[model samples]
Target: MITLTDVHKAFGAKHVLQGVDLTIDKGTSMVIIGGSGTGKSVMLKSVLGLVTPDSGTITVDGNDVQRGDRDAFLARFGMLFQGGALFDSLPVWQNVSFRLLRGALKRPKEEAREIAIEKLRRVGLKPETADLFPSELSGGMQKRVGLARAIAAEPEIIFFDEPTTGLDPIMAGVINELIREIVTEMGATAMTITHDMSSVRAIADNIAMLHDGVIKWTGPVSKLDNSGDPYLDQFIHGRAEGPIEAVR
Candidate 1:
């Protein structure tokens, strides 16, 4: 459903996304794995049109990302940010329905609240949690809220940025399962960028390893262990010595 061909992006002296080429099939979950500063985020942002590539092209369902109505294009996507990113001032319901309460997807306040409650329930949050503030929730609950917000609009595409960050292992597992189930149920195309191997195994139908601003390997998850690509092997095994240099 999404495709990037020979994509390249650079910021001043920093050459990020030197030539990223990837394709995400419809209704499939794709996980991008890479170490810090390898431009995974840059590749994702290029697809989202948040970061323009210096060369090549990005298309979603055959339409060029750079030539669309920004709002309309963006409305088709949902994002679960790494930090949860909930507005501290808004109540839980408000935060979940923030998209529905304004702009292209606007709905009646009551209707939006109802939808928010349903989405919250899907993410394992109770309706009673709706009125509480972000500050009042535990870390796991806050993450659930973020997931609820991401699905509230029923977006065709979902992006997860380090979804398991800051959570305990158990909670991270829960989040991974929820993400997998929700994406499958909604039949949404998912693109997740995370270093967590557990999350990759739980959430990905396919995997892509990005390094040095390029896709070093891309294939089905079943073949991950045997890809024979040194870069991917180093990443998946967390090896200290390999083609990848571990900074001391």
Candidate 2:
């Protein structure tokens, strides 16, 4: 469903993505893993065209991202950012249905609210929570709201950036399971970038380890433990003394 070939991105002299090439098949979940300063985020942004690549091609369903109808291209994708990134001022229902309330998918407020409530329910949230602000929710609840919002539009593809970053382990596990279930049930292509190992095991069908600006390993999650690449082995095992240097 998505392909990046020799993608390169840099901010002046700081090279982020030197040459990132990855292929994500349709109806599958692929997680990009890497330590900090690796190009995982840059690679994702390159695909989203959030950060235009200095060179190379990024295609979704065979169409180059930079050569598409901007809004139409974006309409096919949903994103849940690292932080919940909810609009603080908007009520929960509005935040959940943000996309449905505006632009190409705009609908009557009542209809939008209905859809939002259903999605919130899907993410295990109570309908009455809709009228509350994001601040009123706990971190886990906030994440669920974000997840509900992401699937509210039911786009063909989803991008999850650090889905379990701030939550406790149990809450993170809940989110990981929800993501896996939603992606499977919807049959949507998914690309998630995260360093959380528990999340990696829960959400990935395929795992790609991005390191030094290129994919160092690409294989099924089942093969991750035996990939035998030092960088990946170091990462998955959380070894302090290995090719992957740990901060002091």
Candidate 3:
């Protein structure tokens, strides 16, 4: 399991996370939901070590994240950035297997290319598209490529940042289902940050609500609609007249 105990973080005078205690069971999908500036992304970043916490203990499978080999620890996880952060100069296959081509997970060039193509196919992309550049694919296709890359290494954990941010509703739904399928098939621990309720419903096994520098509520996805927390109700329902400030 991935556990965060008493996690806290601040930037100058602005405090973000405050004593966040979250537990993500192994092989389950946990989606963090919150309004803007509620520290959702910050919390995710802290777990990834992109942003260090002021005080806390973050552990994966009982291994302390901060006290491990950075590269080896990271090798066990994969991240899908919000905007499909693909390199324009590399072909789709190269982008997918970028990690496999070098570093700790390095493989022969031909083997890496093969794995990339296989992963692309897993994400519903054609083999021929492997030779194309990111600029040539549509927004949805780009997201698929991003996902293929995320799963290319078959990491034990995957972090998704705004999985469906720019796609149309149908495409978004497709991505959500694809994510669910991939996670379920691989039994990978997933932590996703999204404001998309449709995505939360389709992808999460458990949901946690982050608000006002703390987690207001955390429970199974089935409990979301009836959680009885005004903050959660307001945010999920997209209501302007509730506990949450309308302008925040």
Candidate 4:
């Protein structure tokens, strides 16, 4: 459903994504895992057209992302950012239905609220929570609201960035299960960027490890433990003595 070929991006003297090539099939979850500053986020932004790549091609369902109509292209995707990225000032319902409230996708406020409430329910949130602001919720609840918003538009593709970053272990597991269930129910194509090995094991059908601005390993999630790549081994086991060095 998505493809990137020879993608390259850099900011001034710092080169990130030297050449990233990946392909994600329809109705599957592909998780990209890497240490911080390895360009995982940059690759995602490139696909989203938020940060244009210097060179290469990104295509979604054979539509060239860089050259497609911006509005039409974006309508195909729903993204849950690292920080939840909710509007603190808006009530939960409005944040969940932000896309449906504007432009060509606009719907009656009541209808949008209903959809938002339904989506919130799907993410394991109660309708009562819909009237609250993001600041009124816990971190885990905020993440659920973000997930509800991402799926509110019924997008064919979803991007999850650091889905389990700042929550308790149990809450993170809950979110992971929720994500897996929703993706399966919708048969949506999913691409997630996260450093959490547990999250990868829980949510990924296939896993790709990025290093030095390119994919170093790509394989089935079940095979990650014995993938025979030292980098992959080092990352999964959290070993500090391996080839991957800690940034000073």
Candidate 5:
């Protein structure tokens, strides 16, 4: 559903993506894993056309990402940000239905609220929680809210950025399971950027390791352990000594 070929991006003296090539099949989950500052986020932003690349191309369903009606193009995607970026001012329902309440996807306020509630339920949140603010929720609840917002638009593509950050192990596991289930049930193409190996194991159908601004390895998740790539092995095993330096 998505493809990147010979993609490269640089900011002044800092060269980020040198030649990132990746493909995400329709209705499948693809996770990009790498250490901090390895350009994982930059790759995603390039695909989204938020950060224009210096060279190469990104296409969704064979259409060039950089050329399109901006609003129409972006409307097809939903994003769960790394920081659970909910508005402190808006109520839970408003936050979840932000897109639906305005722009081309707008719905009646009452209808939007109902859809928000349903999405919230899908993420294991309750109706009562809709009226609550982000501050009133726990970290796990906030993450669930973020997930709720991501799927509320019924987007064809979903992007998850560090889905399990800041949660306890148990909550992280819950979030991972929820993400896997939601993506499967919705039949949405998913691209997630996270270094969490546990999240990778639970949510990925295919895995790609990004290092030094390019994809070092890409394959089915089942073959990850036996891939025999030093960079990949060092990353997945969290080894202190390997091809990848501990200090970035």
Candidate 6:
């Protein structure tokens, strides 16, 4: 459903993505694994138009994202940022339905609140949480709110960035399962970036490893352990003494 070809992006003196190429099929979950600062987030931003690539093409369902009308293009997808990115001053329902309350996608307040509560329920949050502010919730609850917001519009595609970050292992597992269930039930194309192997196994139908701004390996989640590539082996096993160099 989404494709990137020969993509490149660079900051003044720091080259990030270098000739990156990837394709995500419709209704499937593709998870990207990489160490910190390897441009995984940058790649996601490129697709979202938050970071415009210096060169190459990004297309969604045959629409060239770089050339298409911005608002129209963005309406087709939803995103859950790594930090939850909620407005602390807003109530939970308002935060979850922010997209529907303003801009061209605006809906009536009551209608938007109902949809927000429904989405929150889908992510296993109770309707009672709706009136609370984000500051009143725990980290896990905040993540649920973020997930609810991402799917509130019932978008055709979803992007999850570090969905399980900051949660305890058990809570992370719960979030992972919730993500899998939501994507499958909505038949939404999903692209996630996470370094957590457990999250990758639970949420990915396919996995791609990014290194030095390029996809070093791509395959089914089941093949991750046996891929036999030194780089893949190093990442999966979390060995400090392997082909991958730890950033000093």
lDDT of 3: 0.94
What would the per-residue lDDT of candidate 3 be over residues 1-248, giving only the tens digit for each residue? 99999999999988999899999999999999998888988998888889999998999999888887999999989888899999999999999999999998999999999999999999899999999999999999999999999999999999999999999999999999999999999999999999999999999999999988888999999999999999999989999999899885
- Local accuracy of candidate 5 as per-residue lDDT tens digits, 10-108: 999999999888999999999999989999999998889989999999999999998979899999999999989999999999999999999999999
1-248: candidate 6 lDDT, tens digit per residue: 89999999999888899999999999999999999999999999999999999999999988888785888788888999898999999999999999999988999999999999999999899999999999999999999999999999889999999999999999999999999999999999999999899999999999999998899999999898899889999998898987789863
Stretches off by above 4 angstroms in model 6 are: none
lDDT of every model, 2 decimals? 0.94, 0.92, 0.94, 0.93, 0.94, 0.93
Candidate 6 residue-pair clash tally: 0
For each candidate, C-alpha RMSD in Å? 1.1, 1.1, 0.9, 0.9, 0.9, 1.0
What's the residue-level lDDT of 219 in candidate 1?
Answer: 97
Task: Name model 2 segments beyond 4 Å from true.
Answer: none
Clashes of 5: 0
Clash number for each model:
0, 0, 0, 0, 0, 0
For model 2, name the residue pairs that clash: none
lDDT of 2 by residue, 42-79 (tens): 78878888889989999998999999699999999888
Each prediction's TM-score versus the true structure: 0.97, 0.97, 0.98, 0.98, 0.98, 0.97
What is candidate 5's CA lDDT for residue 4? Answer: 97
Model 4's TM-score against the true structure: 0.98
Tens digits of per-residue lDDT for model 1 on 1-248? 99999999889999988888899999999999999999988888888888889999899999999996999999999999888999999999999999999998899999999999999999988899999999999988998999999999999999999999889999999999999999999999999999999999999999999988889999999999999999999989999999988982
**lDDT tens readout by residue for model 4, 132-243:** 9999999999999999999998999999999999989999999999989989999999999998888998899999999998899999998998999999999899888788
Name the regions of candidate 4 deviating beyond 4 angstroms. none
